[model samples]
Target: MNVVCIGSGYVGSVTGTAFAVLGHPTTVIDIDPSKIDLLNAGKSPIYEPGLDQLVRKYIGKTLFATTSYQPVHEADVVFIGVGTPSKQDGTADLTYIKKAAELIGAYLHPHRFTVVVNKSTVPVGTADLVTAIIEEASGLKAGEHFSVVSNPEFLREGYALEDVFFPDRIVVGSNHERAKNIMRELYHRLVERVSYEEISKDFAFPYNPLTPKAVYFETDVKSAEMIKYASNAFLAVKISYINEVARLCETLGANVLDVARGMGLDSRIGGKFLQVSSGWSGSCFPKDTAEFLQTSRKYGTELSIVKAAIESNRKMHEFVVEKIRRRLKILNGKKIGILGLTFKPNTDDARQTQASVIIQMLLDLGANIRVHDPKGMEMFKAVHPHLHVQYCASAEDVAHQADGIVLLTHWNEYLQLDWKQMLSIMKTPYLLDTRNFLPKKLLIGLGYQYEGLGIGTEQEIDGGIMNQFSVLSV
Candidate 1:
C-alpha cells in the first residue's frame, strides 16, 4: 500500500515511519520545509525512542518526506495525522486538520477511490467536516471518488514505536465498507502477524504480556473520535483520583503506595495510570479533558467528576509549591533545584508540563530556580525562554548550592542519582518527592529532610521502607 501522511508532526512521523517499516511506500508531508528536510536527512523532527534509527534505516528505502501535497493523487491512503491543538477557550483548534483536508482534496485523483484516514485526535463529526471540505475542494463526491475514515491513533509519546507495532487494539471507524477494507488490508501485517514463538523464541511482549494478538475494533466514526478523548480523560481522572487519595493519606498518616498496591491487585482495578503525582499535564490528557468538558457543555450535559479532576490537578501543582513555601518559610532569595522538566519521562516533550507550571509559581514567589533534565532541557529552554532559569548540565549541578530540591518528573535517571552527593552540594538538604518516587527511609537515613506526596508517617512498615496514600470518589 502507498501511504501518504499529512503534517509531519509527532503523529504523522511515527505513523508514516511505522507504515514504511511494514514495507509500505510511505511519504510524510508537512508545511515546514525544515521538518521535511530533517526527515529527508534521516532524522526525526521530534524526540521518540527508536524513531531516529528507523528514519535512518528507511529514509531512501520505503520512506520519503516532502513539503508538497503533489503525491496525494498517487497514494492509496492519505492519513491526516496533523495536530489538533486546543484553543484558549478549551475547544479543539481544527485549523491544521482543515488545511490538510483542503490540500488532500486539491491533489486527490478524480476517479481513484482513496481512503482518507483521520489519525489526528479530533472531536466528533470531524470526519464529516473533512469529508465536506475535501468534496468542496476536489469537486468530487466523497462516496464515489474518496471516503473518510476515522482511525484515531493511541500512540504513547515515549513508546510510540512499541505502541504502533504492538497496539492493544486497532480501531477503524467508517461507514464505507470499501474504505474499511482498505484500512484492514493496510494494517494486515500488524494485525495478522506470524507467531512470535516462530520468530523470536525468547522475545517477550512487554506491553501486553498475556495477549497473543492485538484486537481489531470496528465502530462508527463519531464513536471512534469519542474513544480517544474518553480514554485520555479516564486516565486523567485516575491520576487525579490517586493524587486526591495521596492528600487524604497525608491527613490520615497512611501510605498511598500500599493503598495503590492493595487496590491494583483487585482484578476489577488492574493498574495502569494510577501513579500519584503533581497532577496530569501533557499534550493529550489536559487538552482532551478540556475538549471533552467543552463538548459535554455544548451538548447541555455536565461531567462533574471530570471538572473536579481538572481542579484537583491544578491544585496539586500548587500543593508542591506550598510544601516548599512551608518548609523554607521565605520564598524570596531562596534557591531551589528542580529535577525533571518534561511532563513525563523518556520523552523530550515540554508542552503543558507540570514542571513549567510549578517553576512559574516558584518564580512568582521570588524563589531562585535551577532546573535539570536528562532529555528535556533543550525543549524546556526553547519553550520557556522568557523565564530566567539556570539550566544545569546535570542533576547535581542543579542541586549545588540550592536550599531545596523538588523531584517533578519520575525519570529513571533520577532514581540512580547519588543522593548523598546531592546533599553535600545543597545549602539545605530538603527534598520534596512530588511523584513519591524515592525511598523515604533511605533519604531520612542520609540526614536529609525528605517529604513525599501523601507520606505523613515517619516510621517504616512491615520491616520495609516507609510508603504512604489511599481514596477519592465523586
Candidate 2:
C-alpha cells in the first residue's frame, strides 16, 4: 500500500516510518522544511529510540518525506497524524486537522477510493467533521470517492515504534464497511507480525513470544475517539491515585513502592503507571484528560474522577515545592540543581513537564536553578526559552556549588551518578528524589540527607500508627 502521513511531528514521523518499514511506499508530510530535510537525510528530527536506525535503513528505499501535498493523491491509505494541541480553555485546537483534511480532499484523486484515517487523537465526532470538510473540498459525494476512518493512535512516546508493530489493541472506528475492510487489510501484516516467534523476539521486550497478539476492536467513529481519551485519562488517574497513596504513606511511614507492588500482584489491578512520581505530565495525558472533561461538560455532565486526577496532578508539584521549602528555611538566593528537564526520559518532548512548573515556582521564590539532562537540554531550551535557567554539561555540573539536588526525570544517566563525590562539591548535601527513583540507603550512607516521595519520610516510623521522629534529623 502507498501510505502518506500528514504532519511530521512525533506521531506523524513515527507512524509514517513504521508503515514504510512494513513494506509500504510511505511519504511523511510536514510544513517544516528542516524536518523534511532531516527525514530525507536518514535522520529523525525528534529523539525517539530505534527511530534513527529505521529511518536510515529506509530513507531512499521505501520511505520518503516532503513539504508538498501534490503527490498525496497517489497514496491508497492516508493517515492524518497531525497534532491537536491544547488551547487556553483546555480544549484541543483542531485547526491543523481541519487544514490537513481540506488539503487531502482538494488534491485527492477523485476516481480512486482512498481510506482517510484519523490517526490523530481527535475529539468525538471528528470523523464526521473531517468527512464534511473532505466532501466540500473535493466537490464529491461521501462514500463514493473516499471514506473517513477514525483509527486513533495508541503509541506511547518512547515506545512508539515497538507499539506500532505490537499494539495491545488495534481500533478501527468507521460507519462504512468499505473503509473498515480496507483498514483491516492494511493492518493484516501487523497482526501477523505479533504471532511469529522470531519477529516477536526481535521486537517484544524480554523476548516474550508467548505474549498474546494485539486484539482489534471495530467500533463506530465516536466510540473510537472516546477510547483514546478514556485510556489516557484512566492511566492518569492511576498515577494520581498512587501519588495520593504515597502522600498518606509519607505521614504513616509506609513504603509506596512496596504498597504499589502489593496492589499490582492482584490480577484486577495491573502494575503499569502506578509509579509514585512527582506527577504525570506529557503531550497526551494532560491534553487528553482536559479534552475528555471538556467533552463531558459539553453534554451537561462532568467526570468527577478525572477532575480530581487533574487537581491531584497539579497539587503534586506544589507538594514537592513545599517539601523543598520545609527542608531549606528560605528559597531566596538558594542554588538548586535539577536532574532532568523532559517530561519523561528517553525523549526530547518537554511539553507540560512537571519540572518546568516546579522550576518556575522556584524561580518565583528567588531560587537559582541549574539543570542537567542526558538528552533533553537543547529541546528544553527551545521549548522554554523565556524561562531563565542555567543548563549544565553533566550531572556533576549541576551539583557544583548547589544547595540541593532534585531528581525530576528518571534518566538512566542520572541513576549512575557518583553521588558521594558529587555531594562533596555542593554547599549542602540535600538530595530530594521527587520520583523516588534513587537508592535511599546508599545516599544516606554517603553522609548526605536524602528524601523521596512516598518512601516514608524521616518523621514517620514503621507502622500505619505514627511515632515521634524529626523531619530535620535525616
Model 2 Cα shift for residue 236 (angstroms): 0.7
lDDT of 2 by residue, 1-474 (tens): 889999888889888987787778899999899999999999998998888888888898889999999767888889999989999999999999999999998988978889999999999999999999999999977898888998889988888877887789999999888888889988887777634454333342444455578898899989998899999999999999999999999889888878988898988997888888889998899999999999888898999999999999999989999999999879999999999888888888887899889999999999999998888889889888977999998788888888999999988666567776798899999889887766665567678789988886663223321122222232
lDDT of 1 by residue, 1-474 (tens): 899999887899999998887788999999999999999999999999778888988898999998989999999999999988889989999999999999999999997899999999999989999999999999999888999998999989898877887888998999999998998899998787634333222222344435567889999999998899888888888999988898889889998877887888988987677778887997888889999999999998977778888999999988889989999999999999999999998799987789888999999999999999999899889878877899999788878889999999988777778877888888998998887777666677777898888767573433222232111000
- Model-by-model lDDT, in order? 0.86, 0.86
Worst ten-residue run, lDDT, model 1? 465-474
Pairing residues by index, what is the TM-score of model 1? Answer: 0.94
Q: TM per model?
A: 0.94, 0.94
As a whole number from 0 to 100, the lDDT of residue 343 in candidate 2 is 87
- Tell me the alpha-carbon RMSD of every candidate: 4.6, 4.4
